[model samples]
Target: MINHPLECWLNLRMDRPLNSGSVSPEELQAWQFGLLRKTISHAVKSSPFYSKQLQGVVPDEILSPADLNKLPVTTPEDLRKNPNSFLCVSQDEVARAITLSSSGSSGTPKRLFFTSGDLERTTEFFQYGMGPLVGEGETVLALLPDSRPGGVGNLFAESISRLGAKTVYPEDPSDIPTILNLLLNSRASCLLGPAIHIHALARLWKSKRLPKNQVRSALLCWDLLPPVAIETISNTFGCEIFSHWGMTETCLGGAVECFQGSGMHLREPDFYLEIADPETGLPVPDGTSGEILFTTLSRRAMPLIRYKTGDLGQIISGPCTCGLSMRRLGDVKGRLDTDILLPTSEYLSMAELNEIILQYVGVLDFKVNYQQQSLALNIALDIAPESKIPTDLSRALTSYPKLSRTVLENNLKINIIIDNNDGSISSGFGKRLITSS
Candidate 1:
């Protein structure tokens, strides 16, 4: 079997002899454990927060991966409280500081600081991660913001250039028509953006009667990739759909999928990933869904030890045909903070609703509101309002097993309001959530 592109990239980074063959899973685990201990010692000696938080702990004592349970997990609140405390480097050494507002009701924002070396490492990861998406000399049009000096899109553009591929960006990512025209004119081989934006462009492409096969593939990131969105893009553009899992903390390049599409292989050399019981904070067995946590192995400016991501995921079990031994992370289900609790204590995840609702035709995007035993859906359709779409969408809502049970037992009323606009109303580049209107 051929080695996965990421595994090949890792070999280059480790400088292993080409004749030595691919690294085994056991070797990767040992390398990660060794680096974890080294990183812990560095963090304890440098970062103020880690020094006090891990006061009594000895880094040398953490000999195995399981020993990480002895350390306390870091939360978003901790970072928001004092980001400077997590800094391991002096202020002069820092290259970029990004302030990200909280997605939840917490008005305070958390800031992440990265040195030039850190940003360079992320750019390298992005370079290798794009192996499965585009080939040399191909053009990748990113429908993402690139104005910032070291933003995610900027880093992606840099990485694509390093890969010997061309990168193009629309004048305004929010303008759907501009993106469509750029795709038609540029004839870019790849499309990279949020899942919804790509889906909307595909919907518009189909509605406009444009030619298909302009894009050979797409790399969807910055948000969850719904199956419905994948099917729509694949059908409309005749392109392969690839999804990536990462966040601001991971420098936006954590895990990526190969052509096999089994799961997203982790950036094991840089990040040591773990899945723990969401409530108990204990490591769960592989394949068990739980909160995702990771410890940085190669961070210099700010090292997050046992950081709780608040996103639900699991480590995939079984061997992949791609011949990579690195652990792969399953699709991230949803955020713990975004799950809406119903009257009966049952929870409805936004991912579940998106899977069912986004599959319907003419349904571009929708905002969910639940209050006082009433569930109102403010839906935006690409096509003009049809008399039957609202009823059909309402029926799809109650079809979920958990939701159907909750509605009947709690007398939940369903309301559907079809917005007359062209799906641009809910096209913001943020995580979709249920709001109380």
Candidate 2:
């Protein structure tokens, strides 16, 4: 492989190939297929679940996007019904066990096992993915949720320690105020956590005149980040902010954003990524939005092939300014389940709702639940004591049209619950439950 100076720089920052500023699309595709074949063959042989599923089938049978459909999609139910079936190693070989819920209200919890090698791979991803947006000797306070024994957080804590970064979790709501002070004086170079928790910190900084850029960067995940919030965070932190994509079932990440600011690069070497039709299991053309379908490339204890991520994104094949041979995803559009349908026949997604609420800046947090037939939109939010609802804000709803039309064209109503805290919002988990019945 030719060592372009730019390529070397990106490689140093990222463990996987990226849009390193001048990667050829053809070369990238070839690299993808080669890695895909090897990962599939290895998983099928070692993973108990995959071995039984692919029994009597040739690894070559999964030749293309279409051929993948011939194999059944993996569901959490399969794991719950027979958890041990996914094991690829014997009892003596298994090094760790982690239990996690799929985040689905109806899904059961799952246990995933990892050998030392799996942890090593995840550790490398952190060094490569988060390292670029970061500088050495900076302290990172992990706002990420504590994944108690055998959960994702435990792994993240281990990873953070490996990165030579210190971690801080509020652990209790009472600690938030104290956490705020530590961030101020700790001269902490980084703050890493979910968008909601980190955003609350930004609001606190906005009001308290806390030191900015004394912090190096913020690593955010777990919820849809509103564009307005991103701008506000960068301004308040006075430093770079980066985000990576991950899923509980897929072992942390599907991709990570680069310093280029173009889009997140798919960790193609670690996972076989494809955008597929949710109903038909067929590949969507590059650059078109569809469900994200993934196959684990780096797996030992458990390997999932052609797993439906339930996340939507676009695949880019054209040239990238940052330049790595691997593919880049246009964006991860949140869960397919976030969409809510009204009797007026309009559809609303959590992303759209977040954009609307954050635009006001007057709001801090809220709980939303749809009413029968969508006659009313009830919004619970924190607002200012002196401020009152602006009629124009209601009018802006139609700008998005489909959702706004329910109130505009139909008899639908909007009831906003604003508990104005003078700009301070409560800290909690699970997306603030914007929509509830």
Candidate 3:
């Protein structure tokens, strides 16, 4: 059997030859600890935030991964308050800076800086991560933004070229019709974009009765992969489905799902990940669900130590079915803050709403508003729907386990508004949220 592409890339990054053997977890952990110490020294001496945060702390004391728990964990608020204080390198050395808006009512946005070398590492990771899905001479239809020089889509396109593959992008990534035409015209074998946009395209394709000729695989990133989206895309396109988990702080490329489909392997050499109890901020045992935290091991512009990712996941214990020893992240759920509690003591999240609503054939996208015990949904369909669309959606949602109890006990009113004549509902990127008004 062929080795996992990421495993081979890890060996090469460590200066070991490819196809030799898998890098032992022990060896990788030791390498990470050494790098972590260096990162600590570098950040303490340069970065204002770390210098103040790590005052009276000694870098040499951090001899192993366990020592990381002793240090302070960074939060998104810290970055938003004073982003410049986190910069280790001079402003002249900063290659790119990405500003992420806060999901809540707060207007402050977190800014991340990256040096040229930092971007190179992410590009290198993308090159190897996509090895199993696309290769030389194959065309990849990248449905991500590429206008910025050091943007995620740009780096991904660069990685495709490095792998000797061709890349094509839609004129407007938000336009589903343009993307479908390009996918057919370019004869691209792989699709890479957010889950909702791809699902919309699949719905349109199915509505048009187009054949799934060239699309062999799809790489879903930048958003949650609701099970309904996966099933719809798979059934409509007859293509393999691949999921990726990453965020802006992670340089937009964290973990990629290998062919085995068990879980997503970490970018071990570049990052040290931890599963921590969200409430206590303490590390959890393997196979136990907790908040995802990661420390940068190879960062130069800005080194983050024990940064909270705001996402929940677990580490799958034992070797992968593909025979590699690298730790894999299990299914990651929604952010901790996304869940809303009802009077009936039931929880509802955008993920659950997505799983229930997107399953409908005509539904393209939906925006949710939950406030004062009233749940209102504005759903966008591919085409004009029958009069029964709203009623059908409401009945289906009330049947969901998470919402059933609340709906029955509280007499919850779920108002569904269907829009079939409008264009696409969402931009097809970024995290989805439930607005309270």
Candidate 4:
């Protein structure tokens, strides 16, 4: 019942006993080194960006993973300023081009080019990564766009079809009723989308007492999924919830979680991942929180070497209870630049705030802002009045030491506003904006 040739290819690959985790450290290092050498050679010869960046560095000199530090780290600024220079192939050879908007003040977007082979690799990853949640003959409802070629939704749909499953994508994700109708009519067993959108739908489905149909699992992709959001969605839907971690720069399908829920297992064969000190660019020990850096091993159109992802997280090295030996990625704690500064020079991360605010029972969504010597927390509620929300939120903030000090010293005042507008909350794609001012 294989629907795509790549499905067979993935099945055969997965059947191999010598997977990333099964191999000895020496064997894995040797394999990674070989791939690294090839990637370095390809990038230096084909990509103008790498050629100039790797001027005096020789590919053969990078005999081990640590040797990667010999080359300069590639930053988002490099991609923004000279994107085409990173392409290993000509424009005609590219199958798709994706533009990722920069998070900086300039607001410039970085364009990434992918060849047919690159797209196929992504499709293959999706087919296998999604294997645990979806089964043959089941329908998967994707709440992402399908209008454009190579969009995450389109690629996901194609992969689901390849796995011998049905996929339904609503014409417009903003239309919640239509989306819910499609899910119910299709009897979709699996749901995949950004965490925020899925959270909203889960609440609506619960409030309306909607029929669950065959829905069994949900995969929250694209952005960080706070623990509160996960618990809420899973409780509302009465299903297992999984998290996926990927970025446009890596062709989107990177790491995914298994049913055991230990952590998001790394796609070790296709991409080499490293946790590095953001300030020093030196590799950090496993279990240490730091920036995520990666090297593309198999991409043909564009090969990014030592590319800094700017994501903040640690790598876990213990054997997963799920029987996976591949290193797992810890829960992403938001970006390095997403820290909120206080008047006392103390810091609060958006991830931390999200964990606290999302725990409040009637809180649907929220945003934070600092202005006029006060910190305002705008919240979207599933309930009315919103009078007790500010007091409730203030009490919650007291649980955090740094926030409590800020409040006690009167260095900052806490304010809460009820915002029903969709614009105030995130649209469930890209990075969540934590502060407006």
Per-residue lDDT tens digits for candidate 4, residues 1-437, read: 32323233333444543322344446555676788789989999999989889998988898876787897889888999989999999899998888877655769899999998888888888887887778899998887643355564578778888879978877766555457678778889899887766776665566567765457899887788877788878887788988788888878877887763678877766788889998888999889999999998888999988889989888887756655545689868788877767766787777787788777655556666656344644434332223236456767777588878877775566666665533123354667756656
By summed lDDT, which 10 consecutive residues of candidate 3 come out lowest? 379-388
Candidate 2 per-residue lDDT, tens place, 54-163, comes to 77666665656556666667866777777788887787777677666655676777777777777666666665566555555566677654456555566665666665
Off by over 4 Å in 2: 1-35, 42-48, 61-67, 147-151, 157-164, 172-176, 382-404, 408-410, 418-436
Native-vs-model 3 lDDT? 0.81
TM-score of each: 0.93, 0.83, 0.94, 0.88
lDDT of each: 0.79, 0.65, 0.81, 0.74
Residues 21-60, model 1: lDDT tens digits: 6688788787788888889898999999999999899888
Top candidate by TM-score: 3
Local accuracy of candidate 3 as per-residue lDDT tens digits, 1-437: 34777877888878877877876778888878888888889999999999999998888888775787779999988999999999999999998888877777778999999998998999998998899899799999887754355575688889999989988987677677777788888889898889888888888788779887668899988777888899999889999988888887888889878762578888887889999999998889889999999999889998999999888899988878776656898878777878777777767788888887887777777777777535443444343223236447777877876667767777767776655434354554667777776
Candidate 4 wrongly placed segments (more than 4 Å): 1-21, 145-152, 174-178, 211-213, 372-391, 398-401, 421-425
Better of 1 and 4 by TM-score: 1
RMSD of 2: 4.2
Candidate that scores best on lDDT: 3
lDDT of 1 at 94: 94
Query: What TM value does model 3 have?
Result: 0.94
Candidate 2 or 4, higher lDDT? Answer: 4
Better of 2 and 3 by TM-score: 3
